[model samples]
Structures are given as structure tokens and as C-alpha cells.
Target: MKKITLWLAALCGGAIMLSGCNMLDKANGIILYGDEEKVLSSLKEEHKGQVEKDSLSVKLMDTDGKRLMIMDETSAQYLLEKELLQEVKDGRDTEALSSIPKLAEGEAFLFAKKEDSDIGFDSLPDQVNYEGNVIIGDGRAYADMFLVVADEDFTAFEAEAKTMGIIQYNKDPDGIGGFDVEREQLVKIEE
Candidate 1:
């Protein structure tokens, strides 16, 4: 009876430790976005065709010249999370950072959407500069998303703002004197 009890306690302890390790691995796993090969191929094709290099977006347009997909690194990160690519990582039982895709700083890419009419280019902000890491929750039925914007060009910033929606500059107003208006007026406006 004593031996059996000790074995049972040891089994439970081991199970708890293994579960904790698995949870940590899931949290730190590498995330990959869209088809890396396709993006690379499109860039090569564009270069070969002598396409103007100044175009900011490498949009994948439909037959009617409507933007259908975007293949930028940011968008790729979004898609990879959306597609739940983490399954591959989990299946392989690997948590090395090397598993993630390494997107170039200014690489050209393409994306394809299920519906051609869904794609739209968002307008850029007039004066805006921000740098941070954002973790997008799992709202959709797929994996959670995360974006790290270490640096940005106007185009990338605009794309992020559009996709994530404008992050409120101020969560709380500075009270009545927040703006140039009077306190009473601000209160009235709030009302």
C-alpha cells in the first residue's frame, strides 16, 4: 500500500510538470505568415518584368485590376496567425525561434483573398509616429496574432493603422482644459 501511494504521487507530479512545460512552449513558439515561396517568386517576377521600383505596395490584383491580396511581411504575420500555423510547430514539438519566417526589411510580396471585392487600401494618416509591440487576441476562430513594429515607413504604418484601426491617441481626455475650449463647454460637449 505504501509503495502504490508513492508511485501515484510521483505520476501526478510528473504530469503537472509536463503540462506546465507544454504551456510555456505554446506561448513562446515561432509564428509564420502567408506563403513565403509565393511572395519571393512574385518579387522576382516583378523585378524581371522591369516594374517600377517606387511602388510602395506589392498588391495582388484581380482580373479587373482590383486589389485582391497583400503579401507584405506585416500582412503575412497576420495571415499566419489567422491560419493557425502554430499547429505545425505544435505537431513537430519544437519551440525554436528559427522555425519562424524571416521577412526582409523592404521585400516585395503578394497576397490573395478568397473574395476579390474584399480588398481595400486604407488612407494614410497626416502626422503620426508610433513604435511598439501589439498582441492581437484570438477573436477569429484561429490562433492569436502579434505584431512587432520596430521601425516603420509611411506605407507600413498606414497599413497597420488601417488593419488594426486607429489606436486612440488619448484614452482619457485631459478633463475640461484638455482642449482649447472652456471647462463648461467641454462638459456640455460630453453631455
Candidate 2:
């Protein structure tokens, strides 16, 4: 009986250590806004292409008319369209979003419904910047989601989880994997 208990305790300790290590690996790096000036400077340095701007956003497109990026002034975000990302992954335009900084490696962008005031990043730290609300989802069931740039070491995730609720969101239908979010522990939405 004593040996069995010791073995079980060792197993539990190993699991806990594994989970802690996984969390550390997912630790977010610095979350910075996509500045238009920085983007333009990079573009000029790389000699990519021209930029088009309307009242809504500033667009950067390649000479072949492939939309590379969109910088939303209101939200202060640089979004890479999905089509471009796919093309790049398929070995077509390998240098598609190279101009933009690749600071989103370990970080995860967790959003909350703007209407859900009861649950949100109320006490965001000085490092985490609220980047305004933006519309998410492509279907008719669109949602107004609030955005925030979480700091490195996931301090924002910890703060939000303590104040609101955190959930794991699985975006793909293949059941591959998911990321942590606020409000619920698990959610799988087909896209």
C-alpha cells in the first residue's frame, strides 16, 4: 500500500511539472501596436510596393495586386489577410508579411465580446494596451470583439482570468488544438 501511494504521488507531481512547463512555453512576448510609420519605413527599406489609404484603413499591396496587409487606424492593428497567409504557406509569396515584425510567435490574441461588459480585461496592466473594438467573424453571425495587446509572460491572461473567465478555444474543425481565452474553460467553434 505504501509503494502504491508513493507511485501515485510521483505520477501526480510529474503531471503538475509538465503542465507548468507547457504554460511557460506559451508565455507571450511583448505586444506592440502595428505602427503605420514603422510599416512604411520597412516597406521603403525593402522596396515592396505602394500603399493605399481610405477613410477606414491603410492597405499595402504587392506589385502583383496581392493584398499583403491592412493597418486599421482606429484599432491600431496590422492584420494579415487569410488568403495572403495561405498563399505564402503554399510557397507562392514566401515574403508576404515579412515587412511586419514577427512578434506574435508565442503570443495569443484573446478577444471578448464587446457587449459582455461583465467579463473583460477591466484592470489591464500598463504594458497591455487596449487596441479598441473591431468586428470579428466572416459569417452573418458577426461579433464585435474588443482587442488588447497582452504583455510578455502572459500577465494580461492571468489578470483577465482572475477578474473574468478564461476558456480554451478550438478554432479548427480538425480538433488539432486551441488557445486560452476568457469566460469559459473550453469552447470549440467551427469555422
Evaluated with lDDT, which candidate comes out highest?
1
Tens digits of per-residue lDDT for model 2, 80-179: 3311111122221122222222224233232322323333333333332322222222111112233333224333233212121111222212211221
Q: Which tens-of-lDDT digit does each residue in 1-191 have in candidate 1?
A: 99999999999989878654443222211111223343233323321212121112222223334422233455445334333222223222322121234444443222221212223334322322221111221111111222222224324543312121101111222222222211111100000
lDDT of each: 0.28, 0.27
TM-score of 1: 0.24
Judge candidate 2 at residue 22 and give its lDDT.
36
| Position 150, candidate 1: lDDT | 21
Worst 10 residues of 2 by lDDT: 182-191
Model 1 spans > 4 angstroms off: 17-71, 75-96, 99-191
Q: If scored against the real structure, what TM-score would every candidate get?
A: 0.24, 0.21
